[model samples]
Target: MISHVLIAIISVLLVAAYLAAVLAGNPVYSALSMGIAFFLTALLFVLLGAPFLAAVQVIIYVGAMLVLFLFIVMMFDLNKSSLTPVRFKPSTILSYFLIMLVLLTGFFVARSVVRMPSGFAITGFGSARNIGFNLMHYYLLPFELASFVLLVGVFGAIAFIKNRRGT
Candidate 1:
């Protein structure tokens, strides 16, 4: 009973923080609010019996990705004057609305399937041990490829920055 109440509270807070992040004026403030949102998401994952996912959410998204976003925002030398309110074009708003509608439709269509999965998971299905084994055995190639791509992207960003500075 208490856990359900806590989950509901956390979920509401998470949505509010996410909205704050999206509607923030400053990029830095947006990034910070997004970090808080990610932390709340991880907390929710922990409450939902997915501790490993929660740890990954905190470590990869909150710790690493948010720091990267902060660095990028800082690197651009953005200031208060540059962060003033901007108006979106009608086309852009319409596109966003259509995309959201499509996503919601798809979600509802999939929700029924999710509620009645064909196969049940084995014991400790979502545990760290199971994840590690599956990652190592089945997903090793794809995982390594993703890491390689990220490494290349980092190198490209460094090169771009260096070129901009003529260094």
Candidate 2:
């Protein structure tokens, strides 16, 4: 009971912090809030009995991705004057309404399916070795593609900061 309460409180705090991040004028604070949100998500993953996913979420997202975002934000030296003010229009309202409609439809559609539960069935090995084996066997192409995307991002960041000719 206590654990459930704590999880619920933390989840609410996480959402609040994410909203604060979005509204914050400072990029650095926004980055930190993003890190907090990622960490909270990792904790939730742990509570759900997926330790491997929790670790990956922390290491890859909170550790690497959020740190990278913070580094870039700091590297650019963004000032308050540089941050653009947000404006809401009729289109924005329409888009949000559409998103809510889709979400409600999904909830109703999923209700029937979620009630049916199959008997306990576990097949896949959750070990690192098994993960690597499957990745190499079936998911090799997509894995390679992701690596290529990372390489492109690396080069793109480097180029973004480089001095251009013909100033």
Best by TM-score: 1
C-alpha lDDT of candidate 1 relative to the true structure: 0.80
- List per-prediction Cα lDDT, in the order shown: 0.80, 0.74
How would you encode candidate 2's per-residue C-alpha lDDT over 1-167 as one tens digit per residue? 54475478678979998997899878788888888888788766655544456678889998888888888787876776867778798999999999999868855754544332232112223434566778899999999999999999989987887779732
Which pairs clash in model 1? Answer: none
TM-score of each: 0.65, 0.59
lDDT of 2 at 162: 79
Model 1: CA > 4 A from native: 81-125, 164-166
**Alpha-carbon shift of residue 143 in model 1 (angstroms):** 1.8
Best-performing candidate as measured by lDDT: 1
